[model samples]
Target: MDMTACNVCGKIFGASSGSVCPSCRKLLNIVYDKARAYLRDHPKERVNAVDLAERIGEDERLVEILMLEGRFENRGEDAEESDDDKKRKQLLQDLQKNLASMPQKQHETGTYGSDRHGARREK
Candidate 1:
């Protein structure tokens, strides 16, 4: 079997017979066009994977795959952004970085809550 890295994420995977791996087969994630356009249109609203997925109605996993390599960055005057836009981008970046550093899930040792069966849930 053949292998290669994803064009967007750089993660290694099989390359049976295409430029893009099977994982990135969908055009939404496979191509950067939409994401680039998104970045431009929402000049003030810095989009995260979740937002993109909701807006485009694609899988969140696919959005993450397309955006894994990028974090919010202000385009500045080149994108004709207003001061508010730059501020929004910076704020979004800060929020995203904070979120990224957080653990995937809470590590709770005790009972979080109870279900209908009266059994406590633990992580």
Candidate 2:
């Protein structure tokens, strides 16, 4: 029989077509379920693997693996973003709107060199 190390726990076990061992697979499934439920309850909350793992109290690595496997691909098209990100985006949009609504200043011609020296005499 062939032996291989489990991807999650690094435990050596009988080799199979899968990268993770049986025990680790079961644990991963539990984590996956928790992640799914959390995401479902908080649909509007953007989260990456690490944040999701922290919220669900699971290992970050497992969540990352599940993400890589496309388990959470179709939940929504919106990408994960933080509160700061949302704030920054809103600020930019507001700035754009403000700039667009403001009236443009009229340009005025000004003298280039030292005005203190003397004023140019027009012929």
Candidate 3:
């Protein structure tokens, strides 16, 4: 019999190919199903491992491990950005470029209020 320690619980058990034991694998499958169903119901919602685990009532480490193992697909990388998203990103890039190209103005001492005299300026 091939015996090994479970990755999640560190319990000695008989295993074959994977690092995780059968019990842990079953639990991970349940978590995976819950996460998948949640994502399916809320297609547009974005969640990290912690958030997903909280929402799905699973361990964050388990979620992260699943993600590392490619059980969960990355929507951001796989899906194309919407037209509005693309436009917004492009506009932001343009604004940043314009701002970067413009010359910076240095602030001078005694520029604003009281203009040399003690009296307050009008505008």
Candidate 4:
């Protein structure tokens, strides 16, 4: 048996894996049940972490942790990507493309220099 600290309450306990202790894990199960029930009742609603926490009367942190644990998922219309999500993905793709081209661009333009004049001096 290994000892670890609970991420939620910061209590030390015996555990072999996961950052949370046994008590926190049990509480998380209860919270997960409530959140699942809420989701079932509001199947079409787009419920973020805060909203779910409010609906279930649980801490937003717990809801967020459950979300991170893959215990909760958006369903139906709520699962669809919003404009902001699309824009975020586009921005990420653009950034990746720019990063991916950096080496090639530097090679083509000979911009990778170690000198103050932007030129490599060979001895």
Candidate lDDT (C-alpha), each: 0.62, 0.80, 0.77, 0.78
Ranking by lDDT: 2, 4, 3, 1
What tens-digit string does per-residue lDDT give for candidate 2 at 43-91?
Answer: 8999999999999999999999888878787753345444665788789
How well does model 3 score by local distance difference test? 0.77
Give the alpha carbon lDDT tens digit for every residue of 6-118 in model 1.
Answer: 76456788787354556566564434555556667776776778887777666676667656544234445446456886898899999998897566335543354334236
What is the Cα-based lDDT of residue 95 in candidate 3?
99
Q: Is candidate 1 or candidate 3 better by TM-score?
A: 3
Model 1 CA RMSD to the hidden true structure, in angstroms: 16.9
TM-score, ranked from best to worst: 4, 2, 3, 1
- Clash count list over all predictions: 0, 0, 0, 0
TM-scores for all candidates?
0.38, 0.54, 0.52, 0.54
lDDT for 96 in candidate 1 is 96
Number of the top-ranking candidate, with lDDT as the measure: 2
What is candidate 4's lDDT per residue for 1-67, written digit by digit as tens?
8887888898888776587777788889899888887886887888889999998999999888888
The local lDDT score (0 to 100) that residue 80 gets in candidate 3 is 39
TM-score of 1: 0.38
lDDT of 2 at 27: 84
